[model samples]
Each structure stands twice: as C-alpha cells, then as structure tokens.
Target: MSNDFYRLSILPHVAIVIKICRAYTNSQEDFEDYYQEVCLQIWRSKDNFKEQCEWSTWVYKISLNVCLTLLKKKKNNYQNFASDSLPEEAIVESHAFADESLNQLFDAIRQLSEVDRGVILLYLEEKSYQEIADIIGTNANNIGVRITRIKERLKKLLDGKIN
Candidate 1:
C-alpha cells in the first residue's frame, strides 16, 4: 500500500492500538515504545494484508502481536537488569480515564494473563465472538468460553480491589 493508503487505512484504528499498548505496558516510556513499534510493524506489514479480514481486525492482530512480543522482550531484559523492581516513576498509570472504577478495572485487567488480557480487551471493545476468534486465531466457541472465564476472573479481581 502507498503511504497515503496506509495512513488512511490505519488512522481509524489508532484507538485500538493505544488501548492494547496501554494494557500491555505500565510505564509511559515502555508504552511509547510499544506504540511506535506497533505502528512501524503495521506499516512494514501493510503489504502482507491479504484482505481476508477487516482492516480493524488486521490492526487488532498486529497490535496484539506487537504488544505481546515487546512484553516478552521487556520481561527478559528486566530480569537481566540490576534492579529487582522498576522505579516508582516507571510505574505510572495511564489515568486517561479519571474514574476510579475504570482505573481499578484496568489494574485488574493488567493482572490477567497476557492472552486473557487481549481477549477481554477485545471483548470490551464490543467485537463479536467470531471477530475476536478470527483475530485471536481460535474457534468462536472457544472465545465465548474464554470470555466467560475471563470475566469471572476479572470480577473476582475487581471485587477485591474495588471494595
């Protein structure tokens, strides 16, 4: 795709990228890195899009893959670093939503397994089970089952944090 085509096609799905990146990262610096890497990967892989799926679905797959890959690398690097824990400054929350409940919800979401986090985020975005299944590369029925379990887990996590 041409630059203009890539820009126009990817523009509408920026929020998806931001949300996935934010969910995968706690620090602003790491979030920015994930966001940039995702955009770059999208641009680089634009030609690989075969139109078998909706543009937004492709964006979701790419964003999720990028975040998961970067998260793994970040974890590995952190293990090698001297500090056992990240600095307080490196643990900033997005705070994009000022609501305490929403923040707590996000905190709870962050605690879920990486795949579960992606599944719930896609579910929260109102993607159909089939659509989420397509993006996450699973059967639609499996998405339904996983979403149910993930919601239960999130509810249990949030119940403690919120109350």
Candidate 2:
C-alpha cells in the first residue's frame, strides 16, 4: 500500500519533500527522521486524497504540515544557516537549480520563517500565487505580500548584511 502511494506521491515530488525537510531540520539524522515520517503520513492518508488539486500540491501540503508539526513538537526554531551541499539525488531532482550559487540562494531561503519557507518553495516550483495560497491556507493577495517580503529578506541574508 505504501509502495502504491509512494509511486503516486513521493516519487514525483521527492525533491520538494527533500527541500522542505531540509529547511525544517538542522542535521542529517533529523532529516532522515522527518523524511520517513512524512512518507509514512502520506501513506497513512493516501486514501483521503480527493484528486481536487494536482497530486503534487496535495503532497506539498502534507509535507509542509508534517515538517511544521515536527518543528512545533521539537520546540526549536530552525537555525538560519544553510548546508554547503544537498544530497546528490536531491540536486539531480532539482533540475531548475543550475549552479552552486543556487545553493547559496537556498541557504538564504532556509533562514525564513516556516510559512515563508513554504511560500518560497511553492513559488520556486512555479506554483501560482493562488495555488500557493490554497496550499498554505491564505489569501492570494496575502501570499503575494508575503512572497515580496520573503524575497527582500532573502536578499538581506544573501548579502551578509543580516545576522
């Protein structure tokens, strides 16, 4: 059953899940834990998928919720640091990412608030503002405002101007 749903959700959206898990965790062990839990939850809830939105969108919602719930349970605000590199498979999965500078960009993005991180990740996936809003449960206008602010914040982080 898990394998069936994994093919339906995890295989295609694995990179998005990896990126979300990466931003929400600080260590490789924690990452693996989160990744597994997210996969488990997706399998657990597989039957509930209504096929209303794209399956990837549903996966994004589930992945973000799992990461945020785990973050809340751990009671730790994730750090404002970035990894020097990502897992090779994740890098290969992220076909949009062109160079090492894109890694710097993700580092900056990781410093954002959890909601901001979700918005930016969806935006990076080229999701419409409305799609992002629907996934994150906010208005499209609010998502637009948030994305604008998140971009400015990422700029500051990348410039070495922010602590």
Candidate 3:
C-alpha cells in the first residue's frame, strides 16, 4: 500500500485493526502478517464499501473478518497478497504494550474463542453494544450477555483456573 493510502484509509483507524490483529495472533510475526493482510483486504474491498455506516465501523468489520479468516487457515497454507512496504514499516514499534497488566489482559484474551476475542476487543475499543452487534451479526442484547460471559471467562483464564 502507498503511504498516502495508508495515511488516509488506515491511519485514521489503525488502532481498530491493530487491536484486532493483536488479540488473534500468537506471536509478533503472525500479528504483522495479519495486519498487512487486513490493510490489503481493506484496499481491495474499497469499492465494495457501501457507506452504510461510518468508515471506522467498516474498518472494524473488515479487520475482524480478516483476522478470523486468517486464523482459520493454517499458517503455511495461507498466501499473502500484501506488498513489502507498509506504513508501520516506516514507523512505530511492532506492537506497543502500555503496561504489564495490559499484556496480561491480552494474554487472557487470546485464550478465548476467536469470535469472543473480537467481542472483547471491540468492547475495549469503547464501541457501543449496537455497533458490536452489527459487526458480530447479532443483536445488542446478545452482545451485552456475551460481553458479561466473556469477562467472566477472561477472569478465569487470567486467574489460571482455565487454560
């Protein structure tokens, strides 16, 4: 992707993609792969964007779908269509963890099912339940219930009660 495209289409919503990528990948290399794939997919699907919602919300849906799809594909079997250059390659750390607790939180989050991981990541991003429901293909009430259950599951995982 070109610098200008990344700046306009992705930089504005990079956090949403980055967080979803982070929650789904087991290692830095996988995170980078997922990030690049998400960016490429975004650009590939640009014209398909119907503008039914905010650009950032469209970004969230694409990012989540790409992450989930990549996770389902075995590592060696996946073919990447991304370019060698990425905006992040020119700047920023591979992944930024603000604190140890944040790392612990992500670790716990990784233990959840893929769909649940997206739910909690969206929740942490402060997206409204309705927005999350839209992305997850469910209603707001189910999202609320899922969030409650996901939190409890995360707590157990963090407490070392589940693996």
Off by over 4 Å in 2: 72-99, 160-163
Candidate 3, residues 16-48, lDDT tens digits: the string is: 888898887656777888999999999999888
Measured with C-alpha atoms, the lDDT of residue 42 in candidate 2 is 83
lDDT of each: 0.78, 0.74, 0.78
The deviation in Å at residue 116 for candidate 3 is: 0.3
In model 2, pairs of residues that clash are: none
Model 3 alpha-carbon drift over 4 Å, by segment: 72-98, 160-163
Give per-residue lDDT, candidate 1, residue 9: 74
Which one wins by lDDT: 1 or 2? Answer: 1
Which lDDT tens digits does candidate 1 get at residues 1-163? Answer: 4678557977788899988887777666777888889988998898899999888999999999887766345653341132224343443455756788887787667667678889999999999999999888899999999999989978986776676
Q: How far is candidate 2 from the true structure (C-alpha RMSD, Å)?
A: 6.9
Q: What value does the lDDT take at residue 150 in candidate 1?
A: 89
